[model samples]
Target: MSHDAAMSVQHPQDIDQGHVVARYVSNERRYLKLLGGGFLRLGEAERAAFIAALRADALQVSPEEIGALLGYEWRSRLTAAWLVGVARRIEWRERVGELLLASELTYAGQGYCFALAQFGGKNDAEILVSYLDRYLPHLECRYDQGLALGALLRLDSRLGTSHAERFAVRDGLWERWVDALPHTRGTADAWADASRSRIDAWCNLWDA
Candidate 1:
């Protein structure tokens, strides 16, 4: 899916009840996508509203709802992961870690990475390491290695750990991964940019 595609706001009545994000109001769903950074065309006022709405909605989302969202398809799972980060739901760390390691769906791992980065603990660091450990070897996979590495690097900065050191060395996994990309930007730039947007979106929710 094109991340830059313009997403229309759905009305509460227009949204299907079976949709993973349908539990949230239409505006919340729209803002959630904004938070996801897949839709970048928003005014400042809408951005502020997205942050506030996400903050309020995260608190209201239940454990069961979150679990179900994670169990659902990529969009729901993505939203669930973002909510986990915004709410700082540490209890869901293991589950999100499992999903991150699984690398089940496209784009969803970005959310998982963001959640782990928000949790920002040794275990989360280990999970990111495990992800890099698993996927970095298979250059053909081309999954979330960049996002995982970026998140791990961010966590290492906060935790003062060298977890990302081996992967990021000269002509190391990081270099290999970047070179393997078909449409990669500068080294680590794509990962750093996307990860920053994801973290900043949820962090702003908390800051609000």
Candidate 2:
């Protein structure tokens, strides 16, 4: 046999082992894309299988590879955070921290912070708190702050709420916002106007 052909050959027992080597451990975009439309469109059994396979593959990837996802597209970032959270991938938590610090404070950034909370212990929560301390002053919109606060509450309830005084909109206000979010649905412009009005009110309250 040619050397290449010889290398390709495997014993029956070795075939299963060889298949394992071919399995994906990273490149999340590729795996999720290969699932066709997305995980949500899959049937129940297939979705579970896909999730299980992704979890297994996530666990196999190096911390560095997982960390790299902090800088990737939103889907990849969310996936990385989910994997880190479930796997308790402590070694990669620093990368999540970088995401928190570098975040643009948009909806996408809020999701990144939310996913990051799933990864570590008290110290990780503390890091977020500290970051928020610095982040609060320059914040212009309430949309992202609402998401960040919710994640912090998940992290450490007492500590997170302790900082509530610094927020212009209290939990009660957010509760009201959620109640109001659905009413503006029929018109996109109405939705935007209402959202802008609420955001402005929150900003003005904080500024005052």
Best by lDDT: 1
Clashes of each: 0, 0
Cα error, residue 139 of model 1, in Å, equals 0.7
Model 2 clash pairs are: none
Candidate 1: give its CA RMSD in angstroms: 6.5
Indicate the worst ten consecutive residues by lDDT in candidate 2: 1-10
Scored against the true structure, residue 86 in model 1 reaches a CA lDDT of 78
TM-score of each: 0.79, 0.51
lDDT, candidates in the order shown: 0.71, 0.47
Q: Rate residue 96 of model 2 by lDDT.
A: 67
The residue-by-residue lDDT of candidate 2 on 25-55, one tens digit each, is 2343433433212554668987667667665
How well does candidate 1 score on lDDT at residue 181? 66
| Cα error, candidate 1, residue 162 (Å) | 1.5
